[model samples]
Target: MLLLSGCKVKASVWKWLHIAISCFVTAGGLLLLKHSGVVTGGTAGLALSLSPILNIPFHYLFALLNLPFFVFSYFYMGKSFTFTTIIAIAILTGLSSLDSLLPAFTIPELPGAIIGGAFIGIGLIGLFRNGASLGGATILALYLHRKHGINPGKSNFAFDFIVIASSLFAYSLTNGLISVLSIAVTSTVLALLKRKLATVKPGESRAIHPASVN
Candidate 1:
């Protein structure tokens, strides 16, 4: 992980732990997606939609495919974010291989999209709460926020809709539309909660806004 000059390495042990949990959540969120047969948006979602055509499991494909993006983030982003994404990718790969062991768990495409989208949205927000983000379009969204001073919610919404739209080729246009709707509903809920957590609440005891780290 990158550190500020004169900062000791020991300071990051806790951050590392948080990174690990964030990765786990990323994995779990993806697992939910595959089980539900919902085509999610994002690069991983792209990989997922193509997996069946290539006869590859989404998890393994995701791990391998995301490598380039991870490398890009490592160089252009920062060390800590890259480390978290690496762990996140590993966890997701492991989780994806479980299609057999957890063969019985099934979420209809609609419910799957709703629940999985909600979980994934909330998961990303949780990572951001810890002073990082989910590391996909999230990186670009950060860049947009810095470049144009756009709100985080607006940036995320635009990118997420793009991802969700790409699902049309994987599922029929109808199912794809359903998935988009589901993700939209949940993502909006998550964005609101993120803002709520950020601005501080009345009578708050311990506030943990992303800005606190800076």
Candidate 2:
């Protein structure tokens, strides 16, 4: 019982740390995207598009948009996975919203897109390693990758194309293209990292069950 209690404590600590790191990176990426006047794919992109039009907070919209996805995820990803995902999403939502309070800063479009995409990718890696996800297109991509042997990166990028294309209506063509570049960078990095992470031992706590985030 003592050993079991110790393990529980360790797991709980790991979960909180994972949530913090992922949320920080995700918030940083979203801030950059916002400053660059762009959007990427997944639930985040939807939130970005609607936030301005609906005049709602991005964090609230992000969490609300993911509600249905959570239900579906519970069925597909199992209870523990879905629960962790909820925690991850909640943290990300809160942190991303808090980022609005940060002093204004800006970056060049191309560099912002690249760096922001990488940050998002890093955040997702943390979430995935912790058996959590942002829940949206990411859930679908992970499901397909796990069950059908499809490349999640390609699948994710395919969905992103539609999301970025739709943004052309809301943003300039240049910005839309930059959004695509961000998504491309995100997907590519995720693919490479996923492949590398696959080689890690489960005992190391780096090979969690497949799940996805926005």
The global C-alpha lDDT for each of the candidates, from Candidate 1 onward, is 0.62, 0.79
Predicted structure 2: lDDT: 0.79
Question: For this target, which candidate reaches the highest TM-score against the unseen true structure?
Answer: 2
Candidate 1 local accuracy as lDDT? Answer: 0.62
Candidate of highest lDDT: 2
- Please list all clashing residue pairs in model 1, or write none if there are none: none
| Cα TM-score per model | 0.73, 0.88
Which residue ranges in model 1 land beyond 4 Å of their true spot? 1-13, 146-148, 196-214
lDDT of 2 by residue, 2-43 (tens): 999997787778666876787789788878888888788888
Per-residue alpha-carbon lDDT of model 1 for 1-214, expressed as tens digits? 3566334344355455554565566656667777777776666677778888999877767666666777667776567656655665565567567656774776677777776777776666555544455456765654455446556566776776787676576578777776676667546755676553323211111223245545
Each model's Cα RMSD: 6.5, 4.6
Residue pairs with backbone overlap in model 2 = 133-212, 134-213, 134-214
